[model samples]
Target: MGACVGCGGSQSPGVFVLEAGTYARCDGCGLASLDPLPAEGAAGALFEEGYFHGGVAGGYSDYDADGALHEANARARWALVERHSGAPPASVLDVGCAVGTFLVEAQRRGAQVAGVDVSPWARAQAEQRHGIGVAASVEEVAARESGEFDVVTFFQSLEHVPRPDRLLAGACACLRPGGLVVIETWDAGSTVARVMGKAWQQMNPPTVLHLMGRPSLAALLGRAGFELVTVERTSKLVSVGLVLHILADKFPALLGWLGVLARRPWLARLTLRYRLGDLVTAVARKPLAVVGT
Candidate 1:
């Protein structure tokens, strides 16, 4: 394993990237990816039991607090929605659309939104609760749903996939010409990563196989046959706080609730570090001429 998207140096490499301070930078494309990504089968288990739907959703309780999180999510949704002016396309697809938050927002804006997620629990909850269409798999959705979409979004869901290239290909396939693929992911090259080092929450191992940066991601999209039209770095204030909380919680026995008090007060210096970062949003357009790559 060397400098390839899915390739990395094998230090005792099994099937997944298992070390710290080491990454496989793709030669084909400069997208730095973690090698020995989770096994194909292991992905489902890791996602189902290890993170997301596991038990961490509660950590996002701030979202439901007095509708503050919902308000923030709605703001993000509207920002993406406003980006696409004129007419809301005929339909849209949201891959890895957990709980269909964006789907609901898109629907409210008069777009026919459908989503696909691996978790049956999330799908059922979306349909039962939100009344949206959800498929169990991308392949199943592709087969059942035809025609192209105006927009395809993968918010905070790209890094979770073991194979980002394959996932991008699939996402591109679902879009119509001139369609947009709006992606929001953690920028590993951001100041947060630079300052926090390995403690950054997005760097959580065994799950996030790729720590994408702006340049590498743009390269990956170009190679995937998409033109990077617009790139915006949005402040992920809550997410940064969440990462800090995760770090604090990891040392709960040591920090306890007083972790809020920052004993080594120099850390207070990094307080503003949270707001300065971005979620690295890129709106890549599927070429109007090319149907497939």
Candidate 2:
């Protein structure tokens, strides 16, 4: 965690200390990460069934319960990629695609979609419920299929990994030349994040490895041989229960009440369309030419 995930630059502390952790900023690119990040083994465990079903700090709360909302969000977000891509993608690969909600939407729009997620439950849900192809890693997906995807997406999944740069490399390994890489994650430099200071929701460490902004994300894209395309604040539509699920971490007392509220069909059904501006969606393009090829 002391080194920048974007540029391999040394990091220094004293940036922001919230809760029981510290956020260290990279000296070279301003990328911030959880100092003393959780062990890789420990971090890997965060993406299990519970993570998708309300067992972890940053995981979803009744993810399947709000399937309609996720679908709507996916509907809106796929537009973001399409508008920047110049054409509708024929094939798509999604990294860290938990339960494949987004891919399910992409498939509806007439694209062949595949996913890479660490959670077995997530993969099962994606395949069994939606018939979307799901794998455990980019390498596994690349082994069977090489350089065929037209677009690769990482919606709210990049920050969960220990090495964002390495993850980008793995993503590009499956992309055809000139294919697009789309990302959506927390932006540390957003106005609300700056105003919230240590209280920013995305500051949850170990769960979110990097607090990346536009520049750092762009830097990571450059390092991965991607030409930056677009980076902008994005919108989301989420349910009320999902909000409670996110807050359950700092206030575990709410979990029991949350379970009760979730049982109430009316309360669980409430959703809001928000543009809080703390999150960004980025798109980059892989080059048509490579040294080896």
For this target, which candidate reaches the highest TM-score against the unseen true structure? 2
TM-score of 1: 0.78
RMSD of 2: 2.7
After superposing all C-alphas onto the true structure, candidate 1 shows an RMSD in angstroms of 5.5
- Candidate 2 lDDT over 1-293, as tens digits, reads 56788888898886878766788999888899888776543554678788777777777777878888888888887898788888889999989888888888888889998899877778888888888878888888888878999999999888877778878988888999999999998898899989977767787866887899988998999998899988888889888877876666656677788777877879867998767998789989999976785
Which residue pairs show collisions in model 1? 3-25, 3-26, 3-27, 4-26, 15-36, 16-36, 63-69
Whole-model Cα lDDT of every candidate shown, in order:
0.63, 0.83
Off by over 4 Å in 1: 6-22, 27-30, 49-68, 84-86, 237-244, 249-254, 258-274, 290-293
Please provide TM-scores, in order, for all candidate models, with all chains considered together.
Answer: 0.78, 0.90
* Angstrom error at residue 83, model 2: 1.4
Candidate 1: how many backbone clashes?
A: 7
* CA RMSD per model (angstroms): 5.5, 2.7
